[model samples]
Target: MFDSIQWLIGIIKSIRINDIIDILIVATIIYYLLKFIIGTRGWQILIGLFILLSIWLVAKILHLPTIEWIFDNLWSIGIFILIVVFQPEIRRGLAKLGERGLFRYSLISKKKAIDEIIRAATFLAERKIGALIVFERNIDLENYTEGCVKLNAEISLELLISIFIPQTPLHDGAVIIRDQEVVSARCFLPLTINPNIPKNIGTRHRAGIGISEETDAVALIVSEERGEISLAVDGKLFRDLDPLTLRKKLIEVLEIEKPDFIGKLKNKLFGKKKWKK
Candidate 1:
């Protein structure tokens, strides 16, 4: 016990500031990794892998030759197997890691996605259809997809409009669009508990504002009572925007490739002056 205590003391003494930082970085990564993996499909896969790893360690300790030999052989291709099994998660993790810099581009046209959403919102607004569309931005909204219908379909005016047609199966909840794909529909977002929100805005708008508060995502809402388009971002809601204005707002927040000098000049010369407020 004295020897063990001395060894522990030595280890504690040997840990420098650099060591502490290194340990902190690793612990932060593991903490976030576990936080992200929990409640995801990959969580079960992780549990299975852990059980297999535990079995391998147990086999070695118990002198189980057959199991040990099998796992030893399997370990050779284990990395490749893992890559295949966790392909989606790995890709998302890498994309998320590099999203602020290198991997910022989406598979689909950002402008096109926004346009489709605008068209759908216009269609919904004209008929007094209430809608909530959340666009995933720098932050991942994967947690919202749970218990929701996973469409995984490309975003389109028809699809977005159909989902919110009154009395439709998915009409009750918000739609989450990530990149150019409508990741899920009928997603129940956390509602803001703040009483400061105007009484005129309903549950749909509240949900849109709620998600924006928690993430960097931008939300487009169609007010059924007023038949106006609104945007919510950073916990604040902007109400009563036209199509052109909404487009500008989405492009601005989403950080899409900004208009060049020529386009800006065109806007200045010919296009309707960008709307304010």
Candidate 2:
């Protein structure tokens, strides 16, 4: 044990600044890669791979040459298959890295995005146009973007309204907003499995609440039947909201400013009335 400790110390002593930086870069990449894998459809595939690895390790320890050989060959060919399967995720991650390095978001841009979304929501609600709008927060929604309309466009009232129009191709699914831009349109969301949800609550509202249940993202829904606006966060649905209340909820939930943050915190601490079911 003492010799092992000494050996580890010797290795640490030989580390240079560049070596530390290289390690940090690799660690960061791996961190993001794992994060991007979770909440994605490929998560189950990754778990299968891990199980296979465990089996291979056991085979090696047991001196089972045939099992080891099969696993080794499978891995040799399976690496390519993995790349093919995770191609969209890899491409999206690389693109995000490039964007993060190249672009920046100002508070003003976020404000504009909020204004546009509010205007669009109000328009849809008044017209009884069903809409599902999602605001991506700490959790990455890139997993849901695959096969959707990858707009990555500036959030505008006109564009948002157009996308949610009844006859439009992208009107059926949710629009995901990240930072000051719309990351995707027509992205399908998981439906809430909670039985407590009212039977009258349709798929749109269930999908909105479902996403909030899974991640920190906020969902806004426009009810076509009643022309009412609703907010879904943390698996709880807030119903019968006006344009002004919706804007306040967005500012508070997204934590765009200190004042809204304080208000959200206050509400949570005070145990205020929350709309649910």
Candidate 3:
């Protein structure tokens, strides 16, 4: 251990400023890469890989040649394994990186997005038009969005209402708004597999819960049958919320404000009402 420490100290002393800078750059890239994949399915896959590695190590220690050989072969094909297992995640990560600049610029214009969504939802609800709108958060939905009809238009109440008009081609599926733009319309989202979800919930609510379950996105649903507005976040549905309540909930969930007594009181009241129903 003493010799190892001496060698490490010598290596550190021998490193030049350029080498340190290069190391820092590489480390920063790795840090961000891990940050991007954290809490995702990719992280679960990584945990599985680690378990497999531990198993391989045990096999080697036990002199199990066949197991070691199989594990070694799998390790040799690591690149192919990554490609097959993480293609969608990789593409989504790249897309998110590309959009980072746009998102940063759009931060100044987020109020416009909030206003447009509120107006559109209010209009649709008043007209008894059912609409499913998803707002992207940290998790990228690029793969799902790719399967939809792309609409890179500025978000507006009129445009949103027009897209979800009955008999319209894009009226059947959910619309995705990202970076203050309508990224896609008619996007198919997953249906929730939660057995505990109430049987009274329809396909739209199920889809909203499903998408929110899989990603960190917020889903807004305006029900045509009941003309009630619902919000889904993290797979939980908050139904029959008014515009003010919905907006406040969204802002709170999205970390737009610090916690306050009034907000807490409102949430408590809302919780009780929901629980009673």
Candidate 4:
């Protein structure tokens, strides 16, 4: 143990400034990669890979030729195997990096987008209109929105409400929102296959939860039967939220700055209500 400590100290002392920066960059990449994959099936795959690595180590120690050979061949194709297994995660990560770079100079207002969504959801809930709105984060949702009407228009309260109004042509499916734009309407989202979900929840809510489970997107659901608002993210559901709670939740998830007292007061003076807690 003392010898190991000495070796570590020597390595630390020998590290130059550039070496330290390189280490920091690599560490940052690994940290974000782990964070992005956490709470997803990618985490399970990581655990399986770790177990296989341990088994390979044991096989090498025991001179088990067959096991060692199998693991060696596996490692040879590991990069391709990982790409296949983690296709969604890789795509999402790349999308996030590309979006950040492209939108760095853009004047997109996330606050306005959140406000529009909250206003539309509140309007729908008051009238007991069922609506599902999926807010895309990093993941590309094009695969799931193939047949939906392509709008690519700026998001607005009126536009959202009109799309979900009862008897409307696009009322049945979900609205896909990306970067403050209404990407599509009547988009069919994936339904959650979890058996634990209650049977009473309708198809709209199920799809809301489903898309959230499969991607990093957030889903806002307004129920027609109960006239309630709900939020779904990371496969977890927050049900029966009031308007204030919904707004706060969205701001938190979207990493928007909280509204100041005057802004909050103005909203309350208008149609929004203040939640005590």
What are the RMSDs of all candidates, in order?
Answer: 12.8, 5.2, 6.1, 7.5
lDDT scores in order: 0.86, 0.87, 0.85, 0.86
Error of 1 at 270 (Å): 23
Model 1 TM-score, 2 decimals: 0.60
lDDT of 2 by residue, 81-178 (tens): 89998787778777877876624544356767898899998898999999999998877787788889989888899999999998889898999998
lDDT of 4 by residue, 1-277 (tens): 9999999999989989999899999998888787677766688799999999999999999999999999999999999999999998889778868866623743458887888899999999999999999988766676777889999888889999989988889898999987778989989988999898889988988999999999888999999999999998888788999877888888877657766899788768894543332
What is the Cα-based lDDT of residue 78 in candidate 3?
96
User: Which is superior by lDDT, 2 or 4?
Assistant: 2
What ranges in model 2 sit over 4 Å off? 1-15, 94-111, 126-129, 136-150, 165-173, 178-180, 183-195, 199-203, 210-217, 224-227, 242-277
lDDT string for model 1 (59-100, tens) is 999999999999999999999998898888888777767754
lDDT minimum window of 10 residues, candidate 3: 268-277
Best-first order by TM-score:
2, 3, 4, 1
TM-score of each: 0.60, 0.68, 0.68, 0.63
Clashing pairs in 4: none
The clash count of every prediction, one per candidate, is 0, 0, 0, 0
State the lDDT at 146 in candidate 4.
86
Comparing 1 and 3 on lDDT, the stronger one = 1
